[model samples]
Target: MQTIGKIASVGAVAVAAAFSLTACGGDDTAAQPAAAPPAPSSSAAQAAQPEGRECTADDVKTTGNFGQAPTITIPDDCDPPKKLITKDLVAGTGSGAKAGQQLSMNYTLVTWSDKQKLDSSFDRGEPFSLHLGAGEVIPGWDQGLVGIKQGGRRLLIIPPDLGYGQGGNGIKANETLVFVTDAVAVPTDKS
Candidate 1:
């Protein structure tokens, strides 16, 4: 867990010069994993959903059950979205995650363009902990992680604007990111 934090901190150093390091305590964490499968297109992914939100036409997919590392697949002809997309693979029944809370989560990160694995807490056999909405992480994570319940598994497709814009620390410029995160715990302060 600490190793993951250190890794994120290193990335943060690389990104701090380009972006505002606010509303989070650290940077994102992920590692390289084997290439997975391709994802569904925008229409296919959100065709019958009850909500009327506009689909971004991305075809990102994932495999593996909740509480474990997911295998994310990016197509060779994939098109990344302009907005942040959050898809819950496994829903949790616990309280919803809120901003400013201490959150412990297991996650895997990959690139949408080339399907390269960046960092993963699951690979390290530990969960990463951070203060939600603090300047500890990227804007994508700070925004995408909200409302996820404890024990839930979420897939966040983050565009460059919400992610590391222009890229740094092993990431490419204007790259799209794929993140499979499991909300392990959200502990509240009972005063």
Candidate 2:
């Protein structure tokens, strides 16, 4: 596994392409929350978890395995959460990811409101890599994926605030986002 720094250090063209490949890009100055909010989840058919959050990813059904693109089905009547929500669908056994490390993964993004596919690294036949918590991606991803171990599968329900705030690319304003992300690998120089 190679970190983004390793790849970028090789060529400027690769650096440009790598940064532009994902839909999660943001300014380097994007604010980082002092701490991630609590995000308890349910693994069994929307079984009981935490309360008070406006929405949870547990109710969203998914069909797929880790390391592959997932088919996400958002409830037609599901409400957008006021806060970011995360659930580990498949736990991985490895060192947990932390901020500043380079992460590579396959992911599928779907719009919660319309249940439409937005983007996917799996469809491109390549894994997306980024410097975690560096504002290279959306805030929800920076915060939500912090502790996911390599090979884990996680579900993320991101509200507008954490997603494309006013929307960009092809997404509409205030749209909620649903992402099924696989923590494929955390690159290291030794690997």
Candidate 3:
């Protein structure tokens, strides 16, 4: 009986850890908190913009403040991406977000298949922070948000490989996630 109880305890711990990992990007690696993002380059900004090739304006529409969640609308017949796609709707006036920096953002997520609303930070009345390029968030978020400036709003179309992949987050398997995110603040705390 003692052995059985110990086994059960171990199982419980494992389950809890798995849940925690999935809740925050499903990675085992931890992120060291850091400062603000790097300054934006004009060339990089132009490259990051949506060119109506991989992602088109007809596919998604966004409208709102720079540091708050924007209203996102996806067409019912919208097609998902085969790779991660990012489009900066509002260009920020400062430096771009860098790797290892903690970013404060407001965002809304939706499914591309049916345009179903999954989650939104605005609904919670608060923003969320994640370590950029540190795998603290999904791969799509980490990679797609690399060149985004402070106070900028971006649309991220994340494929399954960069998202939840085969084992989805209770919503769907191999899902494609669409996010409208605003980079509110990139605190300059290098300590």
Candidate 4:
């Protein structure tokens, strides 16, 4: 269990790092997995072309289950937002997430630059739990994921300021980030 916890934490860091680096736009050294997928195409045309508007729930195209790992597809032609934007792809009927509450969730992350998948909690076959608004995760996640209901699925598009900022972990500086998350369980215990 400790090993799994460590891996989850590392995965979270990797997700954060993948959105951080700004100077070296093409370096993959920090994000390389033990068995990495093929290098992403560096062509600017292949990057996410945001459609000059704030992303809404209707803008994201998602498939798969709510509160579990799901496949998210962003339109290539859409323009990225300058600030953090979040939309509920699937609304939940349970109580909404609140600050200081504990939440268990599954998530998938992709870079807005090249749309490369960075990390996935669902792929690991486990969910990660954290305190909402507690700074345990990136600022975008900590802020954007709040108010989500249990069993809800959300899409978050995060700009650099709300992400890792200039001191990125593995991600480039000033990079934009995209995340698809499912709030699987909101435990009653706030401790």
Q: Count the backbone clashes (under 3 Å) in each candidate.
A: 22, 0, 1, 16
Higher-TM-score candidate of 2 and 4? 2
Candidate 1 C-alpha lDDT tens digits along 152-187: 899988888777666554566676788898998976
How far in Å is the alpha carbon of 32 misplaced in model 4? 12
A best-first ranking of the candidates according to their TM-score comes to 1, 2, 4, 3
Tens-digit lDDT track for model 4 on 85-183? 898888976677888887877778776665667667777767767777655566677789888887788888888777755433345556677778888
TM-score of 3: 0.67
Report the lDDT tens digits of candidate 3 across residue range 1-191.
Answer: 11111212222333311111122332232222223335558874554444444445447887787766577787544346688778888897577788988887777777665467777777766676667765455567778888788778889887876765543233344667788888888754445
C-alpha root-mean-square deviation, each candidate: 8.5, 10.9, 14.1, 7.2
TM-scores of the candidates are 0.71, 0.71, 0.67, 0.69
Evaluate model 1: give its lDDT. Answer: 0.67
Of the candidates shown, which would achieve the greatest lDDT relative to the real structure? 1
- The local lDDT score (0 to 100) that residue 48 gets in candidate 4 is 38
Q: Summarize candidate 2's per-residue lDDT along 1-191 as a digit string, tens digits.
A: 12222222222232221212243333332222223323535442253322444556777899999977799987644456788889999998677788899888788888775578867878877787777876566667778888888889999887877666544345555667888889889754343
Q: What is residue 148's positional error in candidate 1, in angstroms?
A: 0.5
Clashing pairs in 3: 37-98
lDDT of 4 at 152: 85
What overall lDDT goes with each candidate model?
A: 0.67, 0.65, 0.60, 0.63
